[model samples]
Target: MKKPLMITSLALLAGTFLTSALPDRFIRDQFKKAEAQTELMLAQVAEATKTQPVGKPALVSPRTLTDAGELHMVPARDWTSGFFPGQLWYLYEFTGRKEWADLARQFTARLESEKMNAGTHDMGFKLYCSYGNGYRLTNDPAYKDILIQAARTLSKRYKPKAGIIRSWDHNTAKWLCPVIIDNMMNLELLFAATRFTGDSTFYKIAVSHAQTTLKNHFRPDNSSYHVVDYDTLTGRVIKKNTHQGFNDESAWSRGQAWGLYGYTLCYRETKNPQFLKQAEAIARFMLNHKNMPADLVPYYDYDAPGIPNETRDVSAASVMASALYELSTYVPKSNYRAKADAVMASLAKTYTSPVGQNRGFLLLHSTGAKTFERDVPLIYADYYYLEALLRARK
Candidate 1:
């Protein structure tokens, strides 16, 4: 009788322990909802893209037409052609559909053939999603070579004197050599290229740029500025200003996100304590800001004081969410994980379109190149949004 009673107690104890070890049902439910949402989004994409003409997916807009009877989609003006295949890739992963893979392959081929001869600040978007992802998914050497080539080309743009990659080749002599916070996120492909090719030069340039940014871009409180001009000859930071934000000292939401993720990547790749510390500082600044909304998505600028003028950028939330998840590994297991999980949950619930169909070719609300247009869906937003989802699932 005593033995049987002891066995029963042990069984009860084991059952309780196992139950407690399981993930919270609430979190699991959020993932389920996200999965359902992704499925729905795929359906919508299929419905929308199915009717359109399919030969290499012509870049078209209602406003533009070329003399060659083709819709003229400007290069820098359109930053999302590379992200178009991501929706297809997501569908392929979920549904195991060959058509989706084929479409992804076709998109990758098109991007490779087109090349980045045009001047743009975002080769990472052009190559990472299309070629980097294709190489990861299909193990195609062709895609890998394209990525390697793209990285090599971008690496050439790195100005040793400035210790950072140039942002744009503008008509004005003022911005002939500029560095933007956004370049931090785009430099990962270069790092990856270094890893793949065993070329320290790529990593050297990438790390130098990040180190330069750490010195110049960071504010007193760890918030970041958007753009900084450098002396093309002296490697000196000339000016720091908010090209897209409310003012020079204002905190741009996406810039904060970029710092959070970029520094985290720097830490991961190089294990530099400074990078980790910077990442945490930026994360804390973002987390503690009074201006951010409850959903974790932030206005274009945290310093923007008005109501109607304030605009929430879902892209920032997505990038931060992904960065925080990576950051959790380095941080002690505590509220940080919960914080990261909660941010991801909000992104999955609030920003994710119903059934995942995006009308603007974006998963989140990103104010595209604010200098050019007031607000539009930018391609990198979709790229980062998908990257966060993938990282969260992993």
Candidate 2:
């Protein structure tokens, strides 16, 4: 009888611990709240479009990206243009509502021309976020063609000798060939293109880029710098710095998120052990950072001189939550799920909008760039916030 009572007590204590660590009810409710906020955004966009000319056959460039506390509209060709449609597609996925589906189709259709825009490395963000979801959910034949074309266009930017996709086309005084850590993300589209078309060209290019980035982008401590400049003529690394971070050596929060998310995702598609190990290292560095907040959200930059006084990046948190969810699946001994759940719960409870406000954005307190542009809502923040919720739901 005594032994049985002790076992029962231990079981009860374990249950309590897990309850404290996980917030299932809160995340479930957050999912519903996200769906509701998206519904309101649809109606608001419709009204805004009546005067804004974001009508039929127009690109997916409705108003988003907060500047001066107002969400400004970007051209459809803008790097961020895909997220608005991508959000609508996510809403449709969550609700199974025909209205959301109609809206998603309308917005996604406008970005078709991006398939041929060969100058930018962000074609993945613009195409995969919009058409990738469409292809995944609906199997729309047209989405397939668009994605393949976009992949081909993106491939044009790859510098074979440098073994990386040049991130920006406009020449800069800083470097001739700039390869950002963010460009690692675009490899997913190339992989997808290879799978869709049975063309080994896309697959080889992606693997090469990953290898080059893995060799050059990270530090001994595993925290990554934002940009690696290469000599285009000689394929040699010129400099490493954080263009968007506080300084060259300071670990930028979103840049770290991109490394974690990109490598985790790379491992998933390729099952490459190197990618897996790299993702885990980044995860450990981020989770074990002394300056990380109790809530698991981080300051805009880990080495920012302000420390606790610096603005917290909700965007980075959302990205981390979503990335950690996937990373948790790959490793056997990883405690990443607990941390992931806690971060999502924090975002849902503290950072999220209870007023259903912030121009229909979900999470707040996101810093765009540390150039005194602190505490602003961003379209990518909302997009990844919904994405993290969906991954958590599953």
Judging by lDDT against the true structure, name the best candidate. Answer: 2
lDDT of 2 by residue, 1-394 (tens): 0001111211222123223444456555666777777766666666555554445444345444345444465666788889888988998898798988888898898888889998799988899999999899899998999999999999998888888888986658777888988887788899999999999899888888888999999999999989899876778999998988899999999999999999998898889999999999999999999998888889999999988899889889988988998898888467777678778766755676654566566667888678955776667888888888788677
Model 2 residue 205 distance off true place after TM-score fit, in angstroms: 1.0
lDDT of 2 at 331: 84
Candidate 2 lands at a TM-score of 0.91
TM-score of 1: 0.79
What's each prediction's clash count? Answer: 4, 0
Model 1 poorest ten-residue lDDT run: 1-10
Error of 2 at 182 (Å): 0.9
**The 10-residue segment with the lowest total lDDT in model 2:** 1-10
User: Which stretches of model 1 miss by more than 4 angstroms?
Assistant: 1-77, 114-118, 307-309, 356-364, 369-379
Q: What lDDT is obtained when candidate 1 is compared to the true structure?
A: 0.66
RMSD of each: 10.2, 7.2
Using Cα atoms with residue i matched to residue i, what is each candidate's TM-score against the true structure? Answer: 0.79, 0.91
